[model samples]
Target: MLRLFSFGSGARLTMRTSEDAPLVICGHGMVAQRLIERLVALGHPFNGIVVFNAEPFSAYNRIQLSAVLANEIPEADLALKPQSWFARHKVSVFNHEPVTRIDTDRGTVTTAHGRVQAYSKLVLATGSRPSSLGISGEDLDGVLTFRTLADTRALINAASTHKRAVVIGGGFLGLEAAEGLRARGMAVTLLHRSDHLLNRQLDTTAGDMLKGLLAQRGLNILTGQSPAALLGKSRVAAVQLNDDTVMSTDLVVIATGITPNIDLARIAGLQCNKGICVDSRMRTSHPAVYALGECCQFGTHTFGLVEPGFQQAQVLAQHLCQTSEATEFSPGSIATRLKISGIPIFSCGRVQAGPATEDIQWQDRPEHRYGRLLVEQGQLVGAVLMGDTASGPWYADLIDSGRDISGYRDTIAFGQPYCEAAA
Candidate 1:
């Protein structure tokens, strides 16, 4: 039998009985939710499942957070699973309670409310927290960071009263926030320390093109600049740049980057670098423990994208279910697609060409389209598609297959159909 009880300070406690089948999960985010869904798909009994959610709400689609800010979707639409779904699955969730400590020796986890839960197997999907710039006056009233539904609400409320806003960072999150705020009729100035936007994802050319497109949408892009300090009396009124330039602003959104939430794992003596270390099987240093999502490091890789986390969930679920065909996780070629409407940009695998790599590009200036393919030793290694991304999936497939395209090199830039016809 499963029972719900109110615990300390409005925290909800979900009691479950399954002494023999114990699996305790820490954190309730997209990765954790996916892990639960995958486990259930693999026939793991729901009675065995116990989840600790630090947030008051259930798992929501964080990928659509920008949409929420843009008013394209409501907060309710962000939920990944409804309350009825949990009730139907018989999964016990402790909301507004975070697992404060992990007692690996005793196979127990202590919650914020001092509730100790025992587990036969433990999984950490704590995800990542937004990184701060460590600048002065960051603690002001209007300084914000976007990571959760609550953050989105706060930004929306701030936007309602704020007329001008300055967004730090030109990465995906920063750009999304800038666009969302602009959609809300806020004058937005985007500052990036890099010479070009999305330095990690796109080359200078594509990035510049992106800047142009965004400029057309009324977003102020300031590159090679960073805020030295946020200035105001009690709230952020303006940002002082490193060059002593003062840009008056009503709100500040810091989307610099994210740091993995590994404090709990570190405190529990789990091996960690930038994130919790795990093997290809998603197993942590301890035998009965595993870690995944943005909080985990597999080899030299730490993933920030949803696809990798989802893949890890599937692999970990298979292992937990003791599937006959369980295999080690091998990450596929990750593709990034911007969620902003009207801006069609797709980047997969490598975006830059090394000395040994050859680049094939096709640019249609009139159509505002750009495509580039990186070939190494006769095989497609990477590709970038802007404006027209009809060939994104086909390019991703070719990169994954590692097939030599030397024969079709002449017509490959035309797209998959052209290459196929030529072959």
Candidate 2:
């Protein structure tokens, strides 16, 4: 039996739950919702299903939160599953109530209200929170992190009264926040620590081009800069750069990164590294407990994308339900398709070319369209597309299949249509 833990208060539990054990889930984010849907789709074996959601609402598309912030989509459109779906599925939901303690020995979890509930199987999909930069004035009123639905709402509310915004980080979320804020008529200043935007997903040329495109669309993007401190007496009113340049801002959004919610798993004595350590089947160290999504780590890879989490969900569902389709989670290459500040972009496989790789470049400067292909050992190893991403999926498939593009080397940069026509 694993140890007992009451998160945050240093308390010990001796009581046992009398309620019947069922399939219990902690956290109701997208990954958790996907797991449930897969479980149900495979004819779940559990007697009952129970979900504990820390948020007021159930599962919704967190990715579309940026669209909501930008007013591109209505708030109600964010829901992935309706309230009636849970009711019809007989899945019990406890909203705004989070599991505060886990007694592995008792196979029970306790909520903040001291209501103990037993579980036949427990799944940890606790998800993650925005990463902190540890700069000064982070506790200020107008300083916020953009990762949750609540954060989006808060930012939207701030935008109504605020005239200026400072977004820290130039990654996907930061760029989205800046665009959304700008759409709301707020002046936006985007700051990034790296010299280029989307540094992890785009090469220098693509990154710099993205910066220029966004700048043309009213984003004051500053690369090679980081915030030294957030200045304000009670609310964040300005941000000071490392070079001592201070800019007035009504709100500050920290989109640095995400930190997995692994405290519960760790405190309960489960094996954990960057996240709750799990196998290919998504099972934790404890036999009756499993973990998936951003909360769990597979090998040295920590998931930042939903595709991997969905793959984990499928594998976990198969294993738990003992389905004939039982399979392990084998992460493959996933492409990045994004619309940043109204410009289209896509990238897959390696973003940069190694010394052993060859680069095939194509550009239509007048149309703002560009493509780069990296061929290694006669196979497509990487790709980046901007302005025109109509051929993104075809490029992604070629990279994933490791196809020999040497036959079409001259026309590969022109996209699948040209290569096929040439064939």
Candidate 3:
């Protein structure tokens, strides 16, 4: 039997069958929600599902957060599922309650509010936390990190009064934040410690092209610079750089990077390196306890992208539901698509070529378009497309399939259709 009672705003109490322990899930983010949805679709028993969400609201699309910050979409519109959906599925959700302690021996987890839940199986999807520069005055009122709906709201509120904004980090998230602030009618300056923007995803030439594109869109890009300290009395008013250069700003947004959330796993004595160590099946060091999403590491890889996490969720769901066709998790080349400032960009696999690799380049400078293919032994190893990304999927397919393109090398830079026509 299942019983439910309301406590207060966004808080709920539920009782499940004492006979079979429920499956306890921590962190109600996109990956966690996907797992729940997959289980429900597999016709898994609903009485076994219990979720702990630290956020006040249900799972939402974090990918659209930039739109929210730009005032293009309301926060309420980003929810992945409604409150009624949980009720319909008979899944108990304790909103605004985080699992503080995991007792593996006792097979239980305690919530922040002193509630204890027992579980036959546990899944950690705690996700990642925004990284800070560890500089002085980061705790100032105007210094913020873009990670959640709350953080977006804070930026929106700060932008209303602040005229100048400085965004730290030149990665995808930093660029998105800069663009969102620019869209809000604020003068934005982007600071990146690397020599080029998105150094991890793009080569130097591609990064330079992106910088030029963003500069044309009114973003001030400063590469090879890092913040030494944030200066303000009660709030941030300026940032001091490594070279002792101070730039004035009303608000500061840090989009440096993210650190995987692993405190709970560590406390529970689970094996952890950069993240919680999990097998290809998403099983943790403890059999009953499993992990997935950004908080879990499989082999040497930890995912920050949504596709890999979603794939892991599917595999874990199949395993948990005891599906007959369960498959082992196999990672593929991750692709990245930038969503900002109306600029189309796609990058996948190795953008940089090794000594033995062949590089094919096509540049249409007049149209601000560039494309490159990295080939090794007649197979497509990687690709980068900028300005026009219509052929991104085709390039990705070529890389994924490891197809031999020797015959089409002459016109391959023109993309798939042209290559096929030439063939």
Candidate 4:
């Protein structure tokens, strides 16, 4: 074993080309930052840590990319931490140098520039990649995806000159992209293959309500449609829909979906499904290798949300520290809360109803308010709200706790204040 300088208290750290590799991490995203912070707080068990980041900048708030695109916040405000923080924590980060290969047998990682780093243990947090539309004209100069800061910057730059923009997909990212482009004074058209917006999160009623609200904000909304091809000579000049209808546009932002970045791990012979397979402890097939965040799959469930990733990061940190309080990761209910073009929306638990489940809905057409509660076995199992979301967090709690709402069932849809007063 070769001894390296320590990161904490000047203790010596050791590694070997054969075994007992040094601690190394790939893909320094938000979840990776969380794990590093936890380890730092725990006094760091390693001599020092090395991080490979594909992005030029250090970890930042990716959740606010749309906000930056909308000009609601400055790009500088997205930074979570500066390089000095990592230096102080004794972390060596290779910014913009993505790992190209993983030599599991040699216990080393090779970078794009051919730099090799040995690790005793490794953590994979490569996150995900935005999926393409898989159609012709997709290679046009103005066509792009909205997954990273670079993508956001490209869209913002294009919006300055592009007069018309078309966004495909009605999911969260797609809606946000449409709204951001509209805020930039572009004539925005949003196309969704589903009958309504946010079909996966809200039922038809709520989805329709959201669609109407966005349309009222001057966005051209087209439902149950998808682009057959992007049309232009050099850059995108128009989009051709499946019905053979064409709308002239200068830019196209595709937010279809994301696929986990599992190629490196998969090539290394690690178990991978939709993502890198991990046990409850975030352990991969190899004992010395672990994975977390969007790159990890626990059982049949894969994570796309940050909350689950945060939970996984915490569990992995504890297990690696060998703390007494270390616990297994269990998937839990996650809520969706979003604001598109200044309109608030929220949904949690089961948006869909099962045979044994019942749905109680409320609507105030004059007030432009709507709510729905899913009850199963007399417990609040799901909820969706639009227009007025002050009760969103409270509703989420009830769903998470599985509390019986039978006593206040009649007034539950009215929100927590009324339910509390009535009880």
Q: Rate the local accuracy (lDDT) of all candidates.
A: 0.89, 0.88, 0.89, 0.88
Single out the weakest 10-residue window by summed lDDT for candidate 2.
12-21
Mind giving the per-residue lDDT tens digits that candidate 3 earns over 164-255? 99999999999999999999999999999999989888888888988988898899999999999999999899999999999999999999
For residues 1-423, could you state the per-residue lDDT of candidate 2 as single tens digits? 233446457666543342446799999999999998998888888877989978888989999999999999999999998889888887898989988888788788888877777788899999988899998999999998888889999999999998999999999999999999999999999999999999988889888888888888899999999999999999998999999999999999999999999998898999999999998998899988899999898888788888889889989999989998799986667888888867798989998888898988878766777889888998988889999998889988988898777798888777787888889
lDDT of 3 at 220: 96
* TM-scores of the candidates in the order shown: 0.94, 0.93, 0.94, 0.93
Off by over 4 Å in 3: 1-19
Worst 10 residues of 1 by lDDT: 12-21
TM-score, cand. 2: 0.93
Look at candidate 4 and give me any clashing residue pairs: 7-47, 21-119, 21-120, 22-119, 22-120
